[model samples]
Target chain A: MDQIMSNLGLLFEFPIVNLKIILDGVMIGSLFALAAYGLALVWGVMNVKNLAQGDFVIAGGYVSWFLVKTEWLQSLLGVSDNFVILLGVLVAFVVMGAIGWVCYKLIITKVIERDLFTSLLATFGLAIMMAQIMNLLFGSDTQSLKLEYDTLYFADGLIDLPIAKLIGVCMAAGLALAVVLFMKTSRMGQAIRATAQDSRAARVLGIDTEKVYAFTFSLNAAICGAAGAIIVMVWVIQPFYGITYSVRAFVIVTAAGLGNLPGVIAAGLGIGAAEQYGSHIFGIGYQQAIAVLLLLIILIYKLLRQRRLRQVLQ
Target chain B: MKLKFATLALAGVAVAALSSTASAADCDEIHLGSAISLTGKYATNGVHAKNGYEFAIKKIAENGGVKIGDKCYNFRVSYYDDESKGDRGATLAERLINQDGVQYMLGPYSSGLTKAIAPVTEKYQIPMVEAEGASRSLFNKGYKYLFAVLSTSEQYLASAITLAAEMATANGKDPSSVKVAVAVENDPFSLDIRAGVLEDAGKQGMKIVIDEKLPRDLSDMTAILTKVKLLKPDVLIVSGHSKGAATAVRQIGEQKISVPMVAITHCEAADVTGNFGEFAENILCSTQWAETLTYEDPIFGSAANYEKEFKAAYSEYASKKVPYQTAQASAAVYVFKDAFERAGSLDKEKVRDAIAATNLSTFYGDIKFSDSGNNIAKPMVLRQIQGGEYNVVAPSKFASHKLVWPRK
Candidate 1:
């Protein structure tokens, strides 16, 4: 209790510390928002809650890390290290998109028509398989790329921002913007949104609902892969680290509701900041616990809100 | 016809018994069992430890396997992947004893896994010589059947605290005025490390500014680092196995945390020097054994030779410095071999007694288990990553390089 109080006191004594925490939170939160946005799209369109969402992210990270480590690729490209790393994002996106399509055909397609529990269980199994396979391939070590970029420090170095993380956040924002625009303007995006609204109605109106489902699922995975590629440059990734991203995605999507892009982004940033604050006050041991608690709290709040709405109708 | 068939069956039994006796006279096999982490967070070090055991076993065989009463017995280990979970380790320990009929056992990777397996080994009266588990709590449990070849966890970073105090006094500051920060993972090993640091820091009357536990799936520790920046403590202590060490080094570099001293565990195991390069310089890493030590034995020769041979045998370790986890694991196997020979029997009771009375020297270190089952003859060494090389810098006696204080 005293440590918490003292930590809290430090924030008030140096208000700039708050900015540091929020900045760190927002930078990390943007990546979480990307993963959550993928989850929201999958859930909103296909109604298959992807329990393997985080594994997709980790697999993407490994893909990027492997590419960066390939000396032949580096020599063949004859480009700067930063450009090669950024190129990994594009590569991971397309690769994971193909993987996602394969998964949909092999596993997701089987579970799509089944009950919700079936999809959840199947994806959960997929998540475990993916984590284990990656562990076997990569030797179960935490891997990351060390970017040579400098950090921009401000406020007497109290608030420092790494150029690598800055680039990651910008890329994340750009990806989100591109995704939003595609969903708003593209013909396939309209068909996807139409299928998501009512699959039977779309099929009756001559839309290929099956194609829309595959494309939506693939797009979600591609988005997650790009986010993961960015994450490897900024942070570390391990075979077992996928579950953390999975839980965060669940939290963000649950809090924001499906089909709400702005809500998903806000909730992701909010949860990220809230976690930092909780860890700052309570200590870092409570970081995972804080994430889980926020999830519970959000669920309860939504339940209460729904009850009140039902009572009003009565 | 029935009488002829009975005679044939009797002849078959006699022939089988005679061949078995002949094979036993040639070379008998002593089966040992181990349930180590093979596919989880601890898999890296777990695989290293497994290779250590296998190497030691092969070396012993080449040195004319264990001879007890004019019979040569080769060691064959039955391994099961524990997946790095404590419950899984305990269940596998039971399976090894009850199902596989294994009489002797080898320890798992982490202290948590060791703690779980200790109870099962005790229940089954199995003689287990463990190498990887270092948590002080494991020793205090009074496990008669358990024997550890390495020093306890409390000793891992205790020397770091003493060094910090020594540096403070050299800087013309009162030892009590020194501020310390501790961040450890919330596991049996790291918690015990934290306990040791807190006790030592308390004895020195130093102020503990930041004490925190790292989360299990540790990817980032910037929250703790941000606090360290705010507090500006004299010494920062962290212990979270390999992942924690890697995360700390990466983030400390990015955050530009400039404490006077920063000490952590598992630098070599995590290969932080290789991964982070300049970022890993000047950091104190606690280790069980160093290859530069003068420890030698007939089987593995000197500690340095063991490194060379092990690397030659396991091509994966050719690029990185062999982690002490592997070295200690080989030492544990050596202890078992010595105990079995000294006992002059395959009886579990005799072997257990011999293990409890172990007092020998090996390539890893001198081994003499106290009544509490932890090796008391060996001392933990603290090494600093100087210019990407781990050079011993603490305890003065093992100092290969001077301590670089006030990490740049």
Candidate 2:
């Protein structure tokens, strides 16, 4: 308790510390928002809650890490190391999309329309399988790509921002923007949105609902993979680290209702900041606990709101 | 009917004679069992430890196996993946004992896993010679059947604390004026490491600027690092297994955390110097064994030879230094072999007594278990990573290189 109070006191004594905490939170939160956005898409369209969402992110990280480790690829491209590292994001995006399609055909298609619990169990199993397979293929060691970029320091270095993280955030924002534009203007995006609205109605209106579901699922996987790729450059990734990302993604998606991209982004950033503050004050041991607690608070709040709405109808 | 009966008896006698001759050619096997972390967080070191056990077993076999009275027996291990969870480890321990009927046991990877398995082994009266678990709590449990080849956890970073105080006094400053920061994982091994630091720091009357426990799935510790920056402590101590060491090195570099002295555990196991390059320079790492030590035995020749042969046998470790986790694990197996030979019997109680009375010298270190089952003869060494190589700098007697003060 004394440590917590003292830590809290430090924040007040030096308000600049708060800025540092928030910056760190927001930088990490952007990645959370990226993963959560993919979860939101899959849940909104397929009604299939992806428990393996974090594994997809980690697998994508491995994909990127592997590419960065390939000396031949860097030499063949005749590009700088940073450019090759960034290229991993594109490669992961495409590879994960294809893997996502395979997963849809093999597992998701079987679990689709078979109740929510069934999908959850299937995806949970998938998460374990993927984690183990990755562990086997790539040794269960934490891996990251060290970017040869400088950190921009501010406030006398109290608040320092790494160029890699800055690029990651920008790329995430760019990806989200591209996704939004695709949903707004593209014909396939229109079909996807239509199928998400009413699958039976879309099928009756000459749209292939099956194709839309597969595409949406694949797209979600691609988004998660790209996020994982960015994460590898900024942070670290391990075979088992996927569950933490999965938990954060679920928290963000739960707090922000399905199909609400803006809400998901806001919740992701908010939760990230909240967790950092919790850890800063309480200690880093409570980091995972804080993430789980936020999830519970959001669930209870939503439940209470629903109950009040039901009472009003009565 | 009489002719058929005679033929059957003759055939049975022939079979028995053939089986006895075959058994004479091949040595009898003494099956040992282990529940080590083959998957999950501890897998990296777990695999290393497993390899250590296997290497020792092969070496023992080539040394003509364990001779018991008039019989010779070779060691064969049945291993189950514990997945790095305590509860899962306990369950597998039970399976190894009850289902597999394994009477002798080898210890699991980390102190956490060993803590979980120790109780199960104790309940079944299985004698376990563990190498990886170094938590002081395990020794204090008064486990008669359990013996550890490695030094206890408190000793891991205590020398580093003493060194920090020595450096403070050397600079003509009071040791009491030193400020310390500690960040350790919230697991058995790391928490015990934290406790040791707290105790040592308290004894020195040094102010603790920051003391925090890292989360289990630890990725980022910028929050704590940020605090370290603000406080500017003289010494920073960090202990997590391989992942923690890797994360700390990477983040400390990225965050540009500048402290005079930064000490951590598991540097070799985490390959911090290989991964982080210059960023890992001057950091003190606590290790159970260093190959530079002139420890030797007949089976593995010498510590340096063990490293060479191990790298030859397991090419995966050719790129990096052979982790002490692997070296100590091999030592544990050697202790078991010596105990079995001393007992000269397959009786579990006799074997247990022999293990309790263990006093041997091997490539890893001197092995003399106290009544509490921890090796008391060996001292933990602190090595500084200088120029991408680990050089022992602490305890003065074991110092292969001078201490590089004030890491830059």
Candidate 3:
């Protein structure tokens, strides 16, 4: 009882500590939402759950790193470091998008014709393959890009934020906004949305469902690739780090449902905040556990909601 | 059948060439086997160990190998990839002994794998001296055939705590008033390090403000740093593997959580000094062996010589800094060679006895195992990553650089 009292006292006494954690969460949460948006896109349109989504993110990061390391951009185009970083992101998008297109043509199309379990297994195999390939190419070392941005401290140094993270968040937001606009205005965007609603109906309406599926998967890969590039700038990346990002994306998508952009962002921020608070209160050992626990709770809540809706209809 | 024939022909040609160079048939080869983590999570360190062992074997062979009872025998290593799994290590060690007919063994990468392989080596009555796997619990297992050359994991962060206490006294503050915040990975190695730090801190009468075990994935240290900021501990000690050390340094910079002193374990494995540079400066870390150490040997001449040779051999082996694991791994092989020479015969019991009664100094350190097969004679040195180089700053006897206190 005394322990509990002291714990509560500690909680109430240091509200600023909690606020600092929340701010950290908000920054990290934006990255999670960006990756989750990609996973949601593929799941909604292609009707195939990409188990290799995290590998795509890691691949994108390596692509960005490769471009930044190579001096071809500086010699050929005479660009600055920031311009090189921008070019790295663009190259990641193109390269991963091409790989995604090739993957769809080679493996994804065959798996899409099979059952969900088969598709899941296939993609899981692809995830393992991609991880090993990345390890072979890049070696198993944790890598990050060094950004020259200085940190920004506010409120008398209470809240500390790195400007590199701010740039990553801004790039993520800009890419997300550009994607949304493209979806709203582009001709291929209509085909993807129509195919997502009802593939057979879209086929009957001459929407070319096959092309939509391929484009959607490529687009998903490109988004994850861009997320990876930003993450390499902000956080560190290793060959085996893809699975954690995939889990977070899965959690956020499940919590927010499909196509709800605001809810995706909200769930991402909530998970981030909960993870920080959980690690703080329960100790840092429970940080990853909080994500798995949140996943379980969200799943149960969803099951309960479905049952309640059925009861109400009856 | 065709592939086997070709392989046999190639082997026969190689053997003929070896025989042409050798004068006697009795001096064929001396074989030692090991299960190393060549793949999986510990692959990076495992590759380093592999390279170290290979380099040591090459050096030994170049020096005309070991002389045993009027015959010279070339050293050979039969390594199996354990894939960084404990059960796999255990099973493979058994295979290396039973099926492969190997009499000697080298230890695997981590403490957990060492624990897994110990019983098998013990049951088979094979003497094994490993360079990695430094958990204190392994020494307490009462296994006679198992010997570890590396300093036990418990001593990893103990020196950091001692340094903090020393600095406190030097600064005209009571050592008892110095506060410590510890974040350790919840593994056997890191837990032992935590225990050592806590016990040492208790002896100094320093207060522990925050203590936390990191999760498996090792992400999100913001909360821990936030607490550190509010409480403002005198020293912040982080004990974990590469990922944990990286996370701590990365988040420390991200949060800008300042402390008077910071000491971390496994800095070389993480390449923290090289990767973080200025951010890692003045951060004291415990190392098993440093190139700057004055330890000397007959074959390698000195610690610096061994490092120079290793770099010259493997040019792409990044990090001009020699990790303690590589040096320790080479030392393990040297122990085998030393024991074989002392035993002077192809006898398992004799070699085992020689290893048990072993006391010698090598390029790595003064290696003399206690009754429990732990190297208690060699003390672990602490280094501060200064200007992207690991400068030895502790044990004043081995001090090559001055200690940076308060980390300003």
Candidate 4:
């Protein structure tokens, strides 16, 4: 008990270390929120649960990797190396958008009106297929985009910060805001909201609900693709890493509740900060476990709340 | 016409049967099975191991096979893809032993997969010779049927720490004053390496500032690096595999967390230098084998000759150098060949006994397993990346180049 108290005391003694941890967490949290927003968009608008959300993100990262490897943007278009990442982001969005549309037409369309369990299983299978296909095509290697950026240290080098991560977070925030604006003003955006409210009523009112659903799914893929491109520029990516991203998205969406944009952003950052602190306090091996534990706690809380509400109504 | 056709069919059947028996009569062919990680996370090293095993078989066959008593036996390998999963590897290992009637087996790539397959081999009482899976916990399990070719995981980073102590002593600083920080993956292999480093640090009386466990996927290292910058340890050691090495190299550069020396493992196996280029330079890495070593073999002439042959055979799939995993895998084949010839019989128990008493040198290095089934005689080589090439820098006798102190 004394040892535990000392360990806790050590964590509190260093305010600078805690600050750095929170900064790192918030930056990573923004990326999670960006991906989770995409997941929530599809879930709310189309009611199709996508287990392959992370795979789309990874696929987006790979698209950027492929472009960088070929030097296609630099050689063919004469773009500079610094600008290659931006072009890669655009390409990822379009490529994943097309893939998402095709997925909706083939697999998602059949299971759209069926039970949620059927959609879950179908997407789960889709996720496995995407992971394996990626392995076959890309050859199971961990790859990252190389950026020639300098480190920005503050507090006499006590707090080390990477310029690349700052750039990635900025890009993620900009894309997310653009998505929010599109949903607020565009005709397709209103159609999606209407469909989410009532699909039958929206269809009767001359809104092509099917087209809205497909577009919503594609837009979500685009959002995830852009998020993946930024992630690759910031960190490393592998073929089998899709599931972690999916789980983070699922956790964020469930905690924030459907269609609650502010809550989603807050929950995402909260999870990220909590993860950093959790790993630091309780060894790094339990980092992933913390995310799962947070998910369990939230579910239990929701179950208890529902039980209490039922008793009050009776 | 129908009677004539029937007679022709009967004659064809008789000829086929005679050919089959004639082929079976040649008892000079020895079959070995392997459930290798041909795909998934271990694919990169798995491909290397596969090529090395296949090349060794070809080399031995070219020399007219191994002579056993009055007969000669040629080696052939039958491989199944383990998919880099522990459970799948175990299932494939059992199928190789039972369904394929294989008497000997080669273990899979990673320690986790190897751990799963080791029980299956032991249960069936088949002697399994493996090149990968270096976790010390593996040997401590007391499985008689398992023999590993690579040095144990504990020795992987121990030499790197020893070199740092030597450097500190030469600089007129107290060796005990050398502070080290270690971040390792939370796996059996990484934990074994962590235990080794801690033990060596205690021996040298060095202080360990921060000893933390890295997550398996290596998703984040920023928090750890932030702490590392503030503490400023004399040496930092990182070990996991390719991904862990990649994360360390990348985050270290991004954070500019400069230390006096950094030694990492799995750099050459994962092609870390090839991927990161200048960022990987000046960073020391503990290696299983170096091509510059003066080890000689009857099959491939010298260590350099073996690498030349390997590159020539698989020229299209060129990296800067052949991974040490491939060489170790090939060396496992040599152990079996030597054991088969010494045993002078096809009996499993006799061959196992001969393997236990074996001592041979190959292009990889000397092979002499201790009572615990680890290659205790083999020493881990310390390598530094100089201008994107791996240079041997340790074990004084085998040092190919001088150490670049205070790595830039």
TM-score per prediction, in order, is: 0.88, 0.85, 0.89, 0.87
> How large is the i-RMS for each model, in angstroms?
0.9, 1.1, 1.7, 1.8
Candidate 4 lDDT over A94-186, as tens digits, reads 988998899899899899999999999999999999989988888766888877777798877767778888888888888888988998999
Off by over 4 Å in 3: A1-11, A78-80, B1-31, B35-47, B50-101, B309-322, B337-347
The residue-by-residue lDDT of candidate 4 on B208-241, one tens digit each, is 8878888767667876776677668999999877
What local lDDT score does residue A129 receive in model 1, on the 0 to 100 scale? 98
lDDT of 1 by residue, A176-231 (tens): 99999999999999999998899999999999988898898899889989988998
Model 3 CA lDDT for position A121: 94
Model 2 per-residue lDDT tens digits across residues B309-380: 999999999987788989999998899889999999999999999988888889987899899898999988
Worst 10 residues of 3 chain B by lDDT: B19-28
On DockQ, the leading prediction is: 1
lDDT of 3 by residue, B1-408 (tens): 999999999999999898756533445698899999998878878988988898998887777678887788877889999999999999999999999999999989988899999999999999999999888999887998998888898898888888888888888989999999999988877899999999999999999888888866665577788778777899999976777778777778767777989989777667776556677878888888888989888978899899999998988765556667889999999998898899888899999989987898998989888999999878889988788777999877888999977687
- What order do you get sorting by DockQ, best first? 1, 2, 3, 4
For model 3, how does the per-residue alpha-carbon lDDT over A188-215 read when each residue is reduced to its tens digit? 9878888888999999998888899999
Prediction 3: B-chain TM-score: 0.88
Candidates 3 and 4 compared by TM-score, better number: 3
DockQ of each: 0.54, 0.51, 0.39, 0.37
Error of 4 at B403 (Å): 2.2
Q: What is the TM-score of chain B in candidate 1?
A: 0.84
